[model samples]
Target: MRLRKPKLVLIDLDGTLVDSVPDLAYCVDEMMKALGRAPWGEETVRGWVGNGVDRLVMRALTNTLWDDPEDDEFEAAHPIFMKLYAENTSGRSCLYAGVVEGIDYLKGEGLKVGCVTNKAAAFTVPLLKAMGIYEKFDIVVSGDTTPKKKPDPMPLLHAANQLGVKAENCLMVGDSMHDVEAARNAGFQVVCVPYGYNHGVDIREAGPDAVIDSLAELKNLLK
Candidate 1:
């Protein structure tokens, strides 16, 4: 079968573009320290990511129990996480292998590229900038940039709108079920990479249009 060329490509950040768990875990550790709590491991932080900073903090604070915190506690913790994350944003962060080349190849093919990540804007921008790939995308929509995040389809739909592409003409590339579900709901095609944070679930179980071992393989699909 002939492959289709997407008019627009929407991508996820954490676990998709960058293996950002190190820095994220550092922030979580810092926040926990500030609150007089024990620090969690990097693996724990990876499972907590792919949602947003608030959810990540909530997960970290609850030690993976995912319990709901009171409004005041959540409010206080949010800024602390943000502050800690901002301070250690790029210290140990790096783009996933093949990500830069894949994005460059997509742009060379004349496709509009956008980022639709659940990471908050404050963290997203600095991380991307530090990776030197912030300018690669035509648009960057963070978790708080829209009313709804992934699995709601609103963020992906909004990204499609910004790229001037119909949802059906776009391809969403991410590492989590949230991206697949969001794309499915928005009527866009999707492909998932195996090496992303999928909440400890198998990425194949998420049921994306295609599963690739590396970002570079994406070019073969477009061939």
Candidate 2:
């Protein structure tokens, strides 16, 4: 399929630009410990991400899809996880390979860019700044930026609106079904990477416009 040249690019945070699960895992485990619950390790936490922190906490607490933790228990654990996560956000999180070069290429092409992630602004902003990519995005749409998050398309559409670009002229680059569904619903093109979390499913099953092994290859595709 022929791809449109994007006027703006919206990128996902966790599992797309940065592998943030290590720090997220640490916070999840810490929160569990404080709650007198067994800790879910990093590997398990990897599959529970991309949904947003509250959902992540829910998954960590329940350890299965049937996450019906007691409200009081969840409320107490939530703030603890938030505090630990704020402290651990970027210490072990690093940009995946080719991310920097890809960002440079996007900028060189003069495309407006935004970061739209389910991660809350409290963690997203500091993590991006610490990783030296905060300034790369013209706008950063956190989970709380809009009333709804991915798969609903509000955040992606909101990012395009903020960049003053029409949704059809935007491209969303990410690694999960959430990104693909968001871009599709927003009327934007989406490209997925093979190596990131997709709830333990193959990302190709989500049917992105293209599947790239690394962000560096995006330059060639865009060219």
Candidate 3:
């Protein structure tokens, strides 16, 4: 099915643009090991992503999705994760199929593209650069970039403003509910990729405007 086109499109960084779990999982595991805890393997770490580094680290520490880590515990562990992730950000992360082509098609159609993510700018920029897709976005709104991040609509709205496009006239393509909710809140169209992480749940349950198997399908779905 074809979907309405938008003036601008914002992409999510972690699960949407790249499968950063390998590196993220590694860092989390390493940090856990340093803290004298058993490592949380990549499979488990995958479910804890999409929020942000702070949340990810907290989840790793508590071994639960919603519980908060103790102040002293979190303070000590956060920096260890920061260092581990920084030194190995994109070593194993990779772009999914057709990411480049789909992005190229959007630019070819004269659409403005931006990257919005709950990740800190420090890791987002380097990861995108390492994946060779950094220059593709017109703007990047990170977790720390605005007062709020996804699922609250702040980052997406911020990007639309930076790109000089109306929020309702933009599209958000991502993998998780955070993307779907943010787009809905921001009054933008939304699409999802089935292959990306969605907290171990199917992305279709989030009710995005469309769910495509590949990024290349943007050419088929969009105007």
lDDT of each: 0.87, 0.90, 0.91
Assess every candidate by TM-score: 0.94, 0.96, 0.97
Question: Which residues of candidate 1, in runs, are more than 4 Å off?
Answer: 1-3
Task: For candidate 2, write residues 41-125 as lDDT tens digits.
Answer: 9999998887888888889888875476889978999999988998899999999999999988999999898899988899999
> Which stretches in model 3 have alpha-carbon errors above 4 Å?
none
Clashing pairs in 3: none
Query: If the candidates were sorted by their TM-score against the true structure, best first, what order would they fall in?
Result: 3, 2, 1
Q: How far is candidate 3 from the true structure (C-alpha RMSD, Å)?
A: 0.9
The pairs that clash in candidate 2 are none
lDDT of 3 by residue, 47-160 (tens): 988788999999999989889989999999999999999899999999998899999999999999999998889988999999999998999898899999889999998888
lDDT value, candidate 3, whole model: 0.91
**Comparing 1 and 2 on lDDT, the stronger one:** 2
User: What is the RMSD of candidate 2?
Assistant: 1.2
